[model samples]
Target: MSSQAAAIAPSELLEAARVSKAWPFEEARKIVSRLEKEGGVSRTVLFETGYGPSGLPHIGTFGEVARTTMVRRAFELLMPGVETRLICFSDDMDGMRKIPDNVPDRAFLEPYLHMPLTRVPDPFTNEYPSFGDHNNAMLRRFLDTFGFEYEFASATEYYKSGRFDPILRRVAERYDDIMAIMLPTLGPERRATYSPFLPISPKTGRVLYVPMKKVNAADATITFDDEDGEETTLPVTGGHVKLQWKPDFGARWAALGVDFEMFGKDHGPNMGVYDRICAALGGRPPEHFVYELFLDEKGEKISKSKGNGLTIDEWLAYAPSESLALYMFLRPRQAKKLYFDVIPRAVDEYYQHLAAYPRQDVKERLGNPVWHIHGGNPPAIVLPVSFALLLNLVSASHAHDKAVLWGFILRHVPGVTPQTHPELDRLAGYAIRYFEDFVKPAKVFRAPDEVEAEALQALSVKLGTLPAGADGETIQNALLDVARGIERYQDHAKTSPEGGPGVSVAFFQMIYQVLLGQERGPRFGSFAALYGIDNTRELIARALAGGDLSEV
Candidate 1:
C-alpha cells in the first residue's frame, strides 16, 4: 500500500462508492483505478448531507450524519494532512408540516403552511423563532455532543446571502428536465410542486428571476395579487437551495462542490436521475449511495412525520453514542431493515469485535490477515465505549471494580470508557445531564417491591455471612465462589440437555434471586469474577442494608 493510502475500517464503502454500480463494470473499474492512482490523496474534500427541519430529528436523520463523519475520519487517517469537512445542511427552506408533539408551538406557524421553513416557529421554546434556526440549533447541539465537526445550516445564511441562486436558476432553467426526473417517481399531486427547482410563484403567474449558473440571492421578489386585486409583496425571503427532487440534486451537488453524500433507499429512483444529471451538468455527481432505514422495535420504519420515533436523546438514555455508531456501521448500508430489537446484539457484537481485534504480537508477526478485511485497515474505534469498557476492566485494580452497581456506574465508569463508547456514555451521561439541563426534580431511586425484596434476602442468607470489616477484595472472591457454584450446576445441565442429577435452570435462577436481591442480576460468575469477590459482596450488603436494591 502507498504510504498515502491510510488504513481505514474494514469496510468496502469507499471502494464501492468509487465504482459506480449504475455504470458499466469496465468503466467503473477504470474510474476507480484512475482515482486511486492519480488522486493519490484527497484534498479538501467536502461531504454534504441535508437534514430537514419539518419535525424532531429522528435516529435515521442522525444516522446519515454519523455515517458521513465516519467516512471523513477515514479519509483524514488514510491521506495524512488531508482536510475533510462534513457540512450538515438543515433544509429549513422546506415548508413545515404539522407541529411535532414535543416541538414548541409558535403562533406564527399557522399562516405559513406553504411558506418556507424560515417562517415556521421554534419547535423547542414555542417562541416566534424561525424553524430553520430551531432545527439547526438542535442538530448542532446533538452533533457537538458527539464530537462531530460540521459547518451547520444549509438554508439560513446560504439563502440569506443568495449563494444558492445560480444553483436554483440552473434548476429552474432545467425545470422540464428536472420535472421529468421527479414526476416519474412521484404521485400525481406531488408532481405539481415537486420540482423544487421551478421558481413559479403560487401567489401569481410570474416566473422568479433565478440565476442560471449561480445561486439566486438578488432582490427577485414575488408579488401576490389577491382575488379582489389587492397586491402584496412578501419579500420572497428565504428559498432553500433545494434541488428539484431528483436530477437537480445532481446540479446542486456540482454547484455546491459536494464530493460525497448518503441518502436512504426510499430515494433510489431519485438517485438514478442524479447520476444522469451529473453526466449532463458537467459536474461529477457526489457519490450518492443508498443506506437502509432504521426501524423501531415494532418493525415499522421510523418516521418523524407520523409523530412516531425515538430521538437521539432517547437512544442516548440506553446506550453510548459509540455503540450507536458501531450499530450503524456494522451493517452494509445497503441492507434493507435495521431494527432496534438487535441493539443488544449490536452492543455485545461490538465488544466481541473489539475483543477479537488483533491484540497479540505473535499474531501480528505471523501476518494474520484477519485485520486486513476492511481494505487492510482495522475498523475505527467508532464506539469509544468499546475501548473504554475493555480498558477499564483490563486495567482495573480489582475485578470488583468491574461489577460496580448501576448507582456507581455513572461516577466510576472510567472517563476513558465513556469517551470510547460515546453512544453508551451518552445514555449514562443523559440521566445525569437531563436532570442538570432540564432542572427536573431529583427522581428518588427506589428499590424493588416486596417479592423482589424477599428473593434478595433469601439469596444473601445462602451466600453465607462475611466477617465484619472484610475488605472489598475478599468479599468479591466469596461472591465469585458462590457464583461459580451456581455456574457449576449450570454446566452440568447444559451438557446433559435433559433431566440430570444437577441443578435445574429454575433452581439456578433461585440462587441468583438470593445473591443479588433481584429476580435477575448481572451474570453471576462474570460479574463477581470481574468485580472481585469481596467488592461484590460488600456492594450487595450495602444494597441489602439500604433496603432499596432495585431490579435493573
Candidate 2:
C-alpha cells in the first residue's frame, strides 16, 4: 500500500522537501549547494542574525529571529545529516550613545552616556548587573518561549575573551584599505577625525571616538590623543579597542565563518562596503538578503525611538505566537504594517491554514502555513470557527466568561468540549481580550435609515414566525427571501437607488451595526441560527422599537 501511494504521488513529492519553492527553502538550497561544491556537508554551516541591544526587544526583533529560524529549519530538512548552527549575536558592547525614550527610568541612564551598554546600570533595577544584560535576558526569555534553538553570543564576551583578537589584528593590518572603503562615505568634517579603531578611555571608561595618531600593526597597538591632549597607547587586540560599525560587521562575519545573514533594506548601501572590507581582508562575505522594514498603521516606519508599534508582549497577549509566525512567513520582503488591527485577520488565517491542513495531500500540505508553523509536524485538530467569528459572538452575546463563550462554541462543533479543544479554548480567551482592547472601544452604533428600518422590521416579524428549532439553511433561505421582499417593496414604492443589490447589502450592514455594533460580521443567517433565532429576533425587535440595543 505504501508503495502504491508513492507511485501515484504528485510530482512535487519527487522534489526536495516539497516546499523548495518557498523563499527560505530556496535560499537554504542555494546555501547547501554552495557548501557541497566548496567542501561538502562535513563542515558545519553557520547562520547568524545580529541584534543591537540598544532597547528592549520588540516584535521586529522577534520577526528577524523567527524568520531566520524558519530558514534554518528549511536547511535542516534539505540536508538531514548536515550540521548547522543558528547564532543570535548581540552587539551589547556598543556605546549607549543616547538613552531610548521608550526605556524606563530615562533619568538614571543620563549619566552613563557614551559608556558601553553592558557597563551601564540596569534602569529597570531587575538586578541583571547592567542594562544590556537585562535586555538580553528579555530577548532570551521570549525566544525560549517560542522554543527557538539558538546559541547566543555577546559582543562584550567575544571582545573581552580575546576571541575577536584575530579579526581585530586583521582590521589593524588592513586599516588603510578599510579606511579607503569607509572615508568616501562620510563628510569631510567626520573624515578628518574618523578612525577604524575606537579606543575605550582607560581613565573615564567612556568609548572614545578620537582620531588614531599612529598604528603599529606589527605590535597590534594603536595610539590616540586623550581628552586632555595626552597621548595614550592600547593593544588593539583585546577589549581595549573596538572597530567601527562597518569594519566590525565585516570582521565578525569573517571570524564567525558565517554562511548566511540578512538585514533590512535600509542597509543596502552598507552591504557593498562591508563585502568589500571582508574581501580586502581575504575573507568572503556571507550569502546576504535584504528584507524590507515593518511599518506602523499609518504606513510610517516602525521605529524603536518613536515607540510607535506593537511590542512583542502586546502581540502575544492578543493573539497566539503562531499567528505572528504566519505574519512573518508571508512576503517578508514587502513592507507591511504591524499593529493591533492586523492581529484578528492573522489569527483567522492561522486557523484557516490549520483547518485545511488535514484534508490536503502531501504536496498541498507542504505549501500550507501550518507545515512551516509546526516544522512539518502539524497537529491533528480542527478549529470550529474563526477567531473573528468568536469575537463577534463574544460581542453580541456579551460573554464575559469563557464557559459562556464555550457554550456557543460547543453548539457549533458538537461533541468537542473544552478538553477536546484546548487550542480553541485558548483562542477564545484571545478573542475576548482582543475584543475588549480593540473592538469594543471603537464601536459606534448607527441607526438604520427609514427604508432599512422598515425592511428590518419585516425581517424581524418573519424571524418570529420561524419554528423554534429552525435549521441554519432554513434560516438562511428565510433571510434571503426577506431581502428579495424588500427589493420588491422598493420597486412597488418606486424608491430611488433602485432597491437592487445595494438594498440587501445595506440591510445586512444595518443588522451588523445595530446588533454587533460593527460594519460587518459573521454570515447573518448562520450567526442568527447559532446565536438562537429567538434571541436574534428579540435584538431586531429592540432595534425596530428604537430601544437600547447595547444589552444584546
Candidate 3:
C-alpha cells in the first residue's frame, strides 16, 4: 500500500526476489510471467477480492482482502511503475436466498426473500436504504480502518448504470453455449430449469428463476414466464438480468480485466466453470490462488451465516490487528482452527518477527511475514517480553490494572514506559483480558501427585538456594537440574513408554498445572525471571499449600 519500491529495491534484493522462497514472491512471479506472455503490463493490472453482501462482512472477509493485498504488494515491488488497481467487488444485486439468523426484524425480511439484496430493507438502522448497503458500508469501514488501498465496486451500481451492458449483451448472444457448459454440473431437477440470465420480475420486483421461454439474441432480451404465467420480455442489458453466481464470477473477470484473484479451497471445484464462462465470453481468466479454509472449534468450516466461529470483533477485543494479519499470512494453504487459543501465540510471533527484522539480511527479511505485513518496512516495535511471559506475569502477580502490571514491567525493563512503549501497554491490557476470559474460566488446578510434589519441593528448595539476583537462564538451569535429579522421575524418564513424552516436557507440564493452574505455560526460566525468583518461590509455596495461584 505504501510506495517504497524505488528506495528499497536494490540489485541484490531484485536478484534474490527472482528466486526468493517467499510465497508472495512466488505468486508475483506467476503474475509477471502471465503478463509478459500477454501484453507486458502496458495496461493497469487489476487485482480483485470478491464478497457477497448477504450478511455483515466477517473475519474471513478481512483475511481475503489482507492476503490479496500481500500479493498485490509483491507485484508492485517486482514491476515498479506498472500501474495497479485493486477492486473489492460486492455482489449486492444477488437475490436474498433466505433471511439471516443474525439480523434484527427477521419477520420483515420474509417478504423480501428472493428479492435482490440491494432492494431488501435494512433490518438494523435506517442509515442505509437496504441491508446490502449497510453491510457494504461495514466492509469499507474495516478495510479503511486497516488503511487498505482499494476501490469498492457494487454489482447493483454496475448493473443499473449499464457498466456491464456490453458483457451482458455478449452473454445473451452466447446464452445457449454458456448453458451447455453449466447444465451437466447440475441434476435433472436443476438442469430442467437453468438459464444463464435471471430476469428481474417487472410485476413482483423479485429475481425470477423460471426458464426462459424464448431468447431473442438480436434484441439482447429474454422472454420469460412471469410469476403470474404471463410471457414477458426484458433486455438482458441494464439491471433487468443478472447472471448466476458461477457465471457472474467469470463475467465479472471478463468485464473488469482482472489479472489476479484468490479464494478458499471450497471454490477449487468450480474453477473450471468460472474459467470456461470467462473464456467463452471473450476474456482471459485471472491467476487463481486457493488456500485452505478455516475451521471452527469443532472442525467444521466457519460459516458467516451460522456465526459458529470467531468474529473479527472478538479477535480485536483481545489482540491487535497486526497479529491477525500475521495469522492470515502464515501457512495460508494449510487449514487452521480460527479460535481464541490462537491469539496469544499470534501476538507473540508477530512481535518476534518484528524484533528480528532489523538484524536480518534482505533475503531473510523478504521471507519474513512482517516484511509483507508492512510492505517491506516493518515498524521497530520491540516488545521487551513475550505475550506468554506477560500473561504469566499477570497470572502470578494478580495484576488487575495497568498500574500494577507496569510496576512489574518497569522493574524488568527499567527505561520502558507506557508513553514510549504503547504497544507494550496495550499488550498488558490484552493479557489481562485474555487471562480473565479464557485462561481463568478453563483453568483446572489439581494437587500435584507424589512424584510431582517431590519435584516441586526440590525446585522450591533450589530456588531458595539461588542468590537474590539470579538471572532467568540461571534459575532455569537450576530448575532443570532439580527435575533431572529426582529419583522417582529419573527412573521413569529412563524406562518410560517408547512413544511417551520426554521427562522434561512432563516436568514442565506438571509445574504449569500445579503452580499456574494451566496445563501449559511460557518458558519457565523467562517467566521466573519476569516474576522475580523470590516471588516464584512464593508461587510454589502457594501451590503446595493448595491455594489457587491462578487467581488474579
The numbered model that scores best in TM-score is 3
The TM-score ranking, best first, is 3, 2, 1
lDDT tens string, model 1, 520-543? Answer: 333454444444445555555655
Q: Rank the candidates by lDDT, best first.
A: 3, 2, 1
Candidate 3 clashing pairs, residues 3+ apart or interchain: none
TM-score of 2: 0.92
Where's the lowest-lDDT run of ten residues in candidate 1?
Answer: 365-374
lDDT of 3 by residue, 1-552 (tens): 222222444777778788878888999999999999986678899999999999888888899999999998888888888999999999999999988888877898999999999999989998899999999998999999899999999999999999999999999888888998999999999999999889999998998889988888898989989999999999998899899999999999999999999999999999999999999999999999999999988999987667777878889999999999999999999999999999999999998988777777788888989989988777777678888998888877878787888887777666899987888999999999988898878878889887888788889999998886677889887876786666554534454334432245778888888887788887898898778878888888888887866663
TM-score of each: 0.62, 0.92, 0.95
- Clash-forming residue pairs, model 2: none
Report the CA-based lDDT of candidate 3 relative to the real structure: 0.87
Better of 1 and 2 by lDDT: 2
- Candidate 2 on 150-263: residue-level lDDT in tens? 999999999999999998888889889889999999999999999989899898888999999999899999999987789999999779977788888888988988888988
Clashes of each: 46, 0, 0
**CA lDDT, every prediction?**
0.51, 0.81, 0.87
Off by over 4 Å in 3: 1-9, 491-503, 550-552
Overlapping backbone residue pairs in candidate 3 total: 0
